[model samples]
Target: MRNKPGIKLTKEKRAEMISAIKSYYSAEREEEIGDLAAGLLLDFIIEELAPEFYNQGVQDSYNFMEKQLEDLLAIQKQ
Candidate 1:
């Protein structure tokens, strides 16, 4: 059996991360603040955190992807 890595983060840590990300983008471009914040959080998880939390990577990806698709479809119907 393979040993899983422990990658735990608290809410404070996540908030700190989001703040650093906002600072970086704030220096780089004139992006919309809300979009930048959301994108930063998504990118941080996908790039930094998902591999440790998900033993089965594709399963996590598919689940979120499907939900996003369903949400989009619902919005289209409205």
Candidate 2:
């Protein structure tokens, strides 16, 4: 599997995520998944779902800057 540089998780964190995912499947779906399956699922989530989250973060930053600029303009108007 080609690793994604965009999503970097420490080894401990990676293991935690994989375990959590497996646990979620076991609890919610009543299905048992092994480490390999959990790892693949985590990879898929990072690759597919993370972009939407990243885009939202970018958009939020843009909006915050815009609000700050507006505040600065108001201060200048004073």
Candidate 3:
């Protein structure tokens, strides 16, 4: 993935994500991590993994629109 600027989240959203991360670690790993650690993990994910996911979503949307355009063209008068 290209080096892109860090993703920005609203304060509320960041808090929500940090909570989710903490919950995931508690439930899945049986470990308790603090807010700072959870926030760091969130930063790592956003910086390293989010671009690939974002690219896939963009590709999927493009493919869907392309198919829809093709279908629309098929109905045009000859």
- Stretches off by above 4 angstroms in model 1 are 1-6, 39-78
| Candidate 3: tens digits of C-alpha lDDT, residues 1-78 | 346686789999999999999999999999999999999899889999887999999999999999999999999998
- Between prediction 1 and prediction 3, the one with superior TM-score is 3
- Candidates' lDDT values, in order? 0.67, 0.92, 0.93
Error of 3 at 42 (Å): 0.2
After aligning candidate 2 to the native by TM-score, how far in Å is the CA of 1 from where it should be?
5.9
Of candidates 2 and 1, the better by TM-score:
2
Q: For candidate 1, lDDT tens digit of each residue in 1-78?
A: 134554456768766767766676677875546645655575667556777667577788999999999988887754
Give, for candidate 3, the lowest lDDT window spanning 10 residues. Answer: 1-10
Best by TM-score: 3
Residue 74 in model 3: lDDT? 98
Q: How many backbone clashes does candidate 3 have?
A: 0
User: Which digits, one per residue and each the tens of the lDDT, describe model 2 over residues 1-78?
Assistant: 556677788999999999999999999999999999999999998888888999999999999999999988887743
Write down the worst ten-residue block by lDDT for model 2.
1-10
Ranking by TM-score: 3, 2, 1
